[model samples]
Target: MRAKLFILIFVCCAAALLFPSMPGTDSLKTVFRLTDEPNEVIVRGMSGSALTINISFGDEEVEQLIRELQAPYPLLLLDMEWAERYPEIVQLIKKRNIPTGLLGHAGMNYEQNLPLLNEQLEKYEDFFGTKPLWFRTSDEQFPYTLRNALWDIEVNALGSSVRWHTGEPPPVIEGEIISLPHHREQRITLTDFRKLTETRKNKSLEDVLFNMSIKTKKMPE
Candidate 1:
């Protein structure tokens, strides 16, 4: 009876340790267990004044992004399929030193597609000559299991703070990460994006992220 009681206590303690009561604050904290819900850590260490646009790679924005945008490349989210389809464009993006991130499937059943992520990462490295550190799973349910897997590989799961589509008023530049879905039929064009940038000014993903790193270090322990 004592042994059984001890085992029960141990299990309860373990559970409490692993799953503490959700904090009331909005601070960035890592999830320790499997969860299908979106968590704050997806946008961990994010705090900035300048807005960042993550462009979903498409043919329409190629000229605008490469030549028009000029310096401080906007973040481009690319996948293996798109890379294969437009190798020359990919090369152009590379030559221009545009910041690119790995784009995941629309609705990935991670249990089955987990291995596929690894394969894509390998191909991404081969094509880009560097492993992707930023990953975007477009409006998909990102399970904690997958997030943990990504974190294990030193890759961060990114969340878009605002999503802007064409024909709508520009999104207010309040969030750190703003998404411009160029891949969609009705998406924000470079013309629209430039006007928005002119209003508030935008920063590169690298610059914003580097700022985040500095903010995290200075945070109170």
Candidate 2:
């Protein structure tokens, strides 16, 4: 009982720090466990898979990738540098309602880079005429200062792998922010990812995920 109580306390603290303005551990943990199961009732309600790609550098490839995906893609533009290269692409993303977020690439040092993050957030809003809903740093760990800053701005936090090395569950809520893992528990190969993205238009995300599950089980580790 003591161990369970400690875990509950730890989860609540972690959730509060990592995801601000979100619900408590009881609800969040349920969601985390739900996300862990692919065919669970919670997952099957919508029956779909989603992907997020963080853009660390600038190039025409970024534009091409956006052109392929219509919406629900959290494109984390690393810096303001991409503004010049993909101005129109950014505009297109806004037009399509594709979720745009910021990435802390330059070490994402909250103390030192806070100014940079603020500047880019303003510029992005100006560029797209809308603010971003999410903010993600390069690393999985969310610093105290950064987490509070994101909460203040009402931007959600998106980071971490779906599962931790110690086998802890993913974070479900913070405040207005959500602590999400980019990958799922069921690992898929690079080839599977490529196939899913490349043929996204031709197939629904659920179909790809289902197919990938089958392919992965057949492969020898």
Candidate 3:
């Protein structure tokens, strides 16, 4: 009995030393929240530094310009309003197999349009044959109420900022959502965005998109 007890204690000690629990004893639930706070949380968890550029120009000329530049970038947050007007452009992007995110306007709150939003999201999933990795509300305003609706759907919210230069630094909220400043020329090519995943070997697919917005750039107006 004495020998058995000694062996048990040794085993326990070894286990504790090898695998310690996190500092906070609380269980971490991975629910997606559609708030700026959640966005901040996701950004904090991103390990490798990545870059993101917002292609906000609605003019086809500008898009053509972008394509002409053809810099190796991974993700593009296409303006939904613009894409709605020219859905064919979105289809073109899809054909490229480039990951694209839709950016909504300030008044497009998830709370006001929960049913529609849910339906649209479902349709998006169906249309893409794969769920979108990133979704943003109000390119200018942050939608705080959207959190409740999206928490269950596993879709994260992207934060908005008025001024790129004077925004708060990204915070560690959780690993599901992230917020970023809105700078016109802040740019990322499809190649750089993919490179981000290379550095974060342990992160899930959702986590990569959640944190993508954290790396924003300031462009000259």
RMSD of 1: 13.0
lDDT of 1 by residue, 84-163 (tens): 77788788887876667787765356645788778878988889776776677765346666766776776766766556
Query: RMSDs, each prediction?
Result: 13.0, 13.8, 12.9
Query: For every model shown, what is its TM-score relative to the native structure?
Result: 0.68, 0.50, 0.47
Q: Which stretches of candidate 1 lie over 4 Å from their true place?
A: 1-40, 44-57, 167-175, 212-221
Instruction: Give the Cα error of residue 109 in candidate 1, in Å.
Output: 2.8
159-200: candidate 3 lDDT, tens digit per residue: 332112222333322332222223344543334433433433
Clashing pairs in 2: 19-174, 19-175, 20-174, 20-175, 21-174, 21-175, 21-176, 22-174, 22-175
- Worst 10 contiguous positions by lDDT, candidate 3: 23-32
Best by TM-score: 1
Q: How much is 182 displaced in model 3, in angstroms?
A: 9.7
Highest lDDT: which candidate?
1
> What overall lDDT, based on C-alpha atoms, would model 1 receive against the true structure?
0.57
Judged by lDDT relative to the true structure, which candidate is superior, 1 or 2? 1
lDDT of 2 by residue, 124-169 (tens): 6777565565455655445556655665665645552232222333
